[model samples]
Target chain A: MQAFDIEVTLGRTRVLHGVDFTAKPGQVTAIVGPNGSGKTTLLRATTGEIPFTGRVLLNGEDVARQKPWQLAAIRGVQPQSTTIAFPFTVVEIVRLGLTAGLSAANTDLPVRALEKVDLTGFENRMYQDLSGGEQQRVQLARVLTQIWQPMVDGTPRWLILDEPVASLDIGHQFTVMDLTRDFATRGGGVVAVMHDLNLTAMFADRVVLMQDGRIAAQGTPSEVLTDATLTQTYGCPIPVNTTPPVGMPFLLPQARMTREPC
Target chain B: MSLAVDAPSVHAPPMDRRVQARRLTVALSLLLAVTSVFSLAWGASGTSLWAAMADLAAGRELSRLDRIVLFDIRLPRLCLGILVGASLAASGAVMQGLFRNPLADPGLIGVSAGAGLAAITAIVLGAMLPPAIRELTGNYLVPISAFFGGWGSTLVLYRVATRHGQTSVATMLLAGIALGALAGALSGILVYMADDSQLRDLTFWGMGSLAGATWAKVMAATPIILAALAVTPFLARGLNGLALGEAAAGHIGISVQLIKNTSILAVAAATGAAVAVSGGIGFIGIVVPHLLRLATGPDHHSLLPNAALLGATLLLAADMIARVIIAPAELPIGIVTAVLGAPVFLWILLKRRGALGL
Candidate 1:
């Protein structure tokens, strides 16, 4: 899958300006940047969640032109955050995941997705009763229910995760990351828009940085996470160190406001 | 750092568990069918369930009085009961979803008042109009005018409230309430202008009844009512996604505008058709879906169909009670429903504030 020449404008602000990127089967691409740098906009564009001027090709067809249901068939998405004030059970909430495919036949999609997220055996609990982190897991489980692959082989699935583990504890964070990695190994492609530069460094096979609605930098984690690029994109001095493999890139912010040291 | 934030999990559960929601609908349908038939059989006018059953089994000519009570009166009454109940319930469910509030009801939102006013005007004017117009008065003019009233005000409110594809529920409800009061005032004027006999008929129609139900009216209404029922399933997926709120629903591939607009139209159509047939029944729409949601999950696929069923059943039961309570001298079905529905609804309100435990 590839985002080909995408442009997005939201409420009078040009959020993405002619950004181009690609992710083929069996690889993880991470989008990392500071706040309001357009990373989330880029992910929204790729998923066709927002209107955009560009061609998102899933094996070469334009994504925008596809029927909504048909488009959902190729793309799986976990949005940044969600809220449900109504009372719902874990099982009911999880069932929302299977909505994408009126035809997907995996009866075990919720179970499998929950188990992967380490939320097994909590199926009958009230969602309102769960803690914030647990609710996030159940929402993730809902996605599993929604994006189940009916056929065993040959059809590729693209998972778009927008900071899927930010709310979880350290243990579940790694578990989600590992599951994403396994998804890639199984010939799926994942595009994760995350804030943790360290996690990007550890798991991302390709990295894209956005600033002022354009691709600020794009390459491998080592290529994009350099102190020079970080300072340039963030408009502040940032220090980068080659730490022990923390499974994600580790970037230390040396400055919060000053662009340069005295 | 904003960069440190990870997205909450997007793992949607498998469809099988959700697929089970489909069963809630089927069961609700069966329940509605069972209860509605039972209620229809339980009416007064000295016709017991056994007598009705025996009559059906015998298929013999009824005595003159039995025929008057059964064919001209009871059958029409039963059919109208089903119509009014289903109408109120279906419209209530749609309005609640459209407004995204548990408190929204056709009666409370002023839909019934708007309809009632329009109908009263038609009845008052029937004398000045042609013979055909007078013939349409008693029960007919009321529903037609009420239906118009419901849809007309909705159109005006929708025009004012909707902007660039964003429709706020708060605005719609507030507008509906305000407009409903205005309509009620107009209806009150029509009632004042009504002559002595006209006043009596108007009062009964305003309170709501299935007494005037006839096979002719049922046949006239079946097409639009059935069409609306048939159309609801198409809205199910959109409504389900809508439970996530408008923005999320849009991101998930729903045209939020279309869903909202269609719901407005559907509510108006069903309520209007119902009022044209049964005057104005209150509380059924607000209460039935809330009750059904308690039994079934909140998913629209289940919620809507069950609401339709329970709505029908609840009205049938209310009509039965209306017939039995006063016997030879029947009471309005609306009073029975409100009397029973209010306490149950209040209990629900006191017991649980949000969605039903299910």
Candidate 2:
């Protein structure tokens, strides 16, 4: 799906200017920006959840023109914060995801979604009582449950994660990203809006840096996660370098406020 | 019949046993129907099962007393009970959902006080007119003035609740209390100025009744009741989402403002119609939904229907008991409900003890 220059004007305030992008199948497209940088707005506009100008094309059809249910059928999202007041079980909550775009005949979704996030046993437990990371995983389960149903000939589905791991602990953050990475690996399109630059550098197939409601940079991790963009984005001094500690992608921060010798 | 069994099981199988909004629907329907029939039979005439059956079945030429008792008194009164119970329950459920406070009532927005004040006005003013209209006073002045008063109070509540297209629950609650107090203050002024005879009439009217029920009144009320009932069930999915929180509901394809607006209109219509009929029958609206929660769970699909049915059950039985406790001398149904309800509530409070730490 390509967001063909979406324009959004809420009343008088233009939250998103004419923004253009392409989110392709079989790739991790990372949208990273500071707060109010139109990351969330862009996602919302792309999904047609909010009224916005410009067109979103899914399989070469205008996504905005499709019915809400039609659009929902092809896509699923996990927002920044999901507060569930009712004490529905994890499986119960996740089962709702399957309801958006599928027939009841496909009954394997609940178990598959739980298996995707490694939350199988936690199904019957109260959703609200789970830890933040566990709850985030449960939400991921819902998103997966909604989007990932086996097709007639055995195929995967598309997923969009809007800060899916924002509320999770560091370890669970990796688990979520790894899950998204696996999703992309299994021939699925995954768009992850994230703030963890290190995780983005490690897992992102392509990184798109957004600034002030516009794309500031877009390229592979090495090209986009340069010292200059990092400093500018964080409004602080930081060093961006590489290390071979078990070949993990590493960019350690040397200082908080001091600018690097560019 | 199969639809009831299959629909609930599909959404919620016994193996899963989670939330079944439809199960709640059927259960509430059953409760509402049975209790509504029972309410139709209870009155000063002690409408026997055989008699009510005979009355309906044989098209018996009902005795003049039975006609008066059925058509004029019990039937209208029964219709009013069902209407009032349904409305109050609907409004209260929506209020609880809108405010995200489980304990909130429709009258939290001051509609009751408004209706109460208007009833007082009708009573006080009827005396000034000749005794000619006194015969038609309950049949006339009461409902009209109550509807107007109920609408007036809710208009104020609506204005107070809406701010920047966002209704704050705390603000709405405060506005209701303040508006209610104002109505109460105005009511006190009327009470203070009343003569002894006016005072007696005002006090009794304030106690509330379905004794003055009429088919015309129920016919007038049925539309609003039907309207509330019809629109409310459709909102079950959205209300379930809304119960999560505003942001979450929005994320789940629900327009927050639309739901909030519908809630406002629903509360106004249901509470207005209810108060117009039975004056201010308090506490039932507050407690019925909670009691339903235990039996059917918290899903609005079930909660709402169960609330509607149990609300009927409670008011009907209370009204019936009011007729029988002092045989042929009818005490106000409101007095009976409050008197009976308060003890049950107290027992619950004591049994649970610190559970209601709120």
Candidate 3:
């Protein structure tokens, strides 16, 4: 899938300014940025949740021209946050994916998706009762249920995740990242917004560094994760280091020293 | 973190919520049936169900008084109660789902108030219309006016609430309150101009009663209410999708705008027809859907139909209480529903104070 020269204006502010993005099949493309840098805006535009001036192509079809259900059959999205007011059970919440995908007749898929997200016995648990991490996983399960297979009819489906591990604990974060990697390895396209540059280096096949509504850099993780680029994009002294064994980039932020101490 | 956890089981059989929903539907249907039968028999004139059933079974013509009381009065009243109850409650459920707030009711959106004001306008000022126009509207004038009023207010409120393809629920709710208050103030002014006969008509109509139920009234409302109810099943999937927030619902293939428009239109048409027929019967709209949500966990597929049945039963029971509690004097049905429903509403508020973020 590809987004070409996308421009989004919310009211008077142009949130995204002529951004181009591409996520290839069998690859995890991570978008990392500071707050208010338009990562979410770009994700929303790609998913057709928000309108954009340029075209987002899914399987070479213009997403803006595609019907909602047609889009649902190919790509799944996990929004940054979802506020559910009612007391829906985990299974009930997951079942919505089937209804959305027009695959409501596939009753077993929701359960399978929940199990995939490590929520095997939570079918009847109230959604509001779940922890934030659990709820996030439940949402992932929902998206997984929608696009169950990584590849369908020789075409790769896509998962557009906005900070998929934002609220997760370390263990669950690793679990979710591993799951995305597995999806990509199995020929699914994954475009995720990441706050953790280390995780992006570890898991993402390619990285796009966004700063102020534009892609500041896009390349292999090593090429994109230089100290100069990180410091410039994040506006902080973020030194980059590489793990010796696996050669994955990591960032260490130096805390500023204060003269007056308590 | 190393991937050391055991593989999650993938073979757990999913619970069939459909079966549970079916069971609930059947149970509510039976309860409604029993309540309907009881409502049919227990009326102002001391009529025995055994005798009515026996008379009908024997194929004998009912006595003049029995026929008049049974066919002319109680039966039509019962039908109207059921229809109004179902429409109001189902509309409430759809509204709650559309707003994604359980507290939302049909009345909150000004449909009932608008309908009531229109009915009042027809009652107090309808006589001054030219003779030709008056003759043309005939008996159907108040209801038609009420329906238009309901539709008009809802359209105005919807327009006010929605901007750039998004409906702000806070704006919708606040605007609805303002619209309803304006309509009510206007209705009050109309009330001041009403004569003694028109005042009496207004009083009964305002309080809501099944006493004036007629076959013609029932026929007039059935098509609109039933159409609204029939559209509910189609809405079930979209409403369920909406349990997630609107943007997510849209991402998941729901035409969010289409669902919102259809839901609003259905709620307006159903509530308009109901308020036109039965006056401002309150509580069933708020209470019935809430109660069913508590029991059934807010799946609209079951919630909508169950709310319909329970609403009908509760209204019939309330109408029964309104009739028998005061006997021939007859308390207004709306009064009975409020008396029964207000406490439950308060209880829900208290119980869910934390959940509601109050």
Candidate 4:
């Protein structure tokens, strides 16, 4: 998927200013930034949920020219949070994805997707009664059910997620991230807006760091996750460290004790 | 991998209600059959459906009174009741699904009032029309005007309550009240201008009765109501997707705009035709869908058809009570439904107060 010259103006204040973004098949692309940096707006614009100035091309076709069902056959999207209108069971919610995408014939995909999210036994439970994290996972399962196969025919499918693990516990966080990674490994592209830099570094094949609605840096995690760049982008003293054997980058932000207590 | 190993091995099957819903459909069909028989057999007239059937079984021709009462009067009333009841209930389910609120209903949301106003206008001022158009529309002028009025109100209500594809329940309900009041005020003006004979027609029409049912009225409403009903099966999957909200629903391959537009038109058509024929029957739209949701689940695939059958049955029962309660003098069918349905509606409100965030 490719988006170029994307400009989003929300009530006279331009949020994204001529930003260019691209995500290749068979990889996980993570967009990370501080709050109010327009990461979510960029994602929404690219997904055709909002109007923007420039062009978004998915699978070599302009998104504006494609029908929604045509796009859905090749991709699935998971929002930050979903509020269901009615009292739907977990299985029912998951099953919604089956008819929405290319998996209409696969009746068991909902159960399998739930299993992938480690929510195997939650099929019968009321979706509204679940905890926040469980609801998030159930949503993930639903999205997964939409494009159950990583590749259809010779083309790869895509998963566009907004904070896929925002409400999860640490263990389920790993579970979801691993699922995305597995999807990427199987030739499906995954684009996610991530808040945790460490998880992004660990899971993302390419990282795009945003600052004030512009792409501050974009490259491999090691190239873009330097202490200087991290500190400059976030306006904090973030120290970058590396794992001993694997040479993976990590960050630990230190609080400056400059303010006196009241 | 370890998470998989740590998880429980006992795998319960997914709790799907499709089977039970299908059974409920069968059950509701049977209930409608029983109700229709009772509605046809028991009435103010002495002619009995059982006697008529027995006579047919004995290879005897029916008497003139039996033919007139059974075929002409009772049959048309039964058919209108089924058509109007199905239209109201199916319109309710569609509205609730479209607005993503269980409380959304044509009667509650002023579509009925708008239709009623237009119908009232047709009644009070129909004579002023040019003879050409008047002759052209004849019996169809009121229903067609009412359909357009209903369509206009629903479109306006949708615009006011939804923003960025999210519908606010509070805003929708409040806007419905405002729209209903506006239509009622206009209807009052039209009623004041009505002649004495027109005033009597308006009064009984406002109260809602099956007493006006005729072959002509039933035929006039049939095409519109059936056309509306025919569009709903195509809408089932879209409405199911819409339970997840418009944005998510779009992501899941539904043309959200198409669903919204079709739902609005369907609601307007069904409600308009029913209101044009029967005036203002209240609560079936809200009560039927809510009860079905509680019984089977909120899946519109079954909810809609079952709602039609159940609505038909319930309305017929209500019509029977309206016929028999005062002996020779009949009450309005709307009164019976409101008396039976209002408490159930209130109970639903009280039970779902927290969920509805009211």
Winner by DockQ: 4
Question: Candidate 3 at A223: error in angstroms?
Answer: 1.6
TM-score of each: 0.80, 0.75, 0.91, 0.94
Give me the displacement of residue A54 in model 2, in angstroms.
7.1
Question: Per-candidate TM-score, first chain only?
Answer: 0.86, 0.85, 0.90, 0.92
Best by lDDT: 4
The best-first sequence of candidates by lDDT reads 4, 3, 1, 2
Alpha carbon deviation, residue A253, candidate 1 (Å)? 16
Instruction: For candidate 3, give the docking quality class from DockQ.
Output: acceptable
At residue B353, candidate 4 shows an lDDT of 88
DockQ of each model vs. true complex: 0.13, 0.18, 0.46, 0.64
The C-alpha local distance difference test score for the whole of candidate 3 amounts to 0.85
TM-score of chain A, cand. 2: 0.85
User: Candidate 3's residue-wise lDDT over A130-191, tens digit each?
Assistant: 99889999999999989888998899988999999999976677778878988999999999
Instruction: Itemize residue pairs with steric clashes in candidate 2.
Output: B24-B302
Expressed as tens digits, the lDDT of each residue in B86-201 for candidate 4 is: 99999999999999999998988899999999899998999999999999998898898889889999999999999998888899999999999999999999999999999987
lDDT (Cα, tens digit) per residue for candidate 3, span B54-133: 98999987788888888889889999999999998998898888877776776756778998899899989999999999
For model 4 the local lDDT of residue A34 reads 92
Candidate 3 ranges with C-alpha deviation above 4 Å: A242-262, B1-17, B125-141, B155-174, B195-197
As for DockQ, the candidate ahead, 2 or 4, is: 4
DockQ of candidate 1 against the true complex: 0.13
* Candidate 2: tens digits of C-alpha lDDT, residues B195-276: 8987865665566777767787787677766786777877766677665555445544565667766766666667766776
Candidate 2 TM-score to native: 0.75
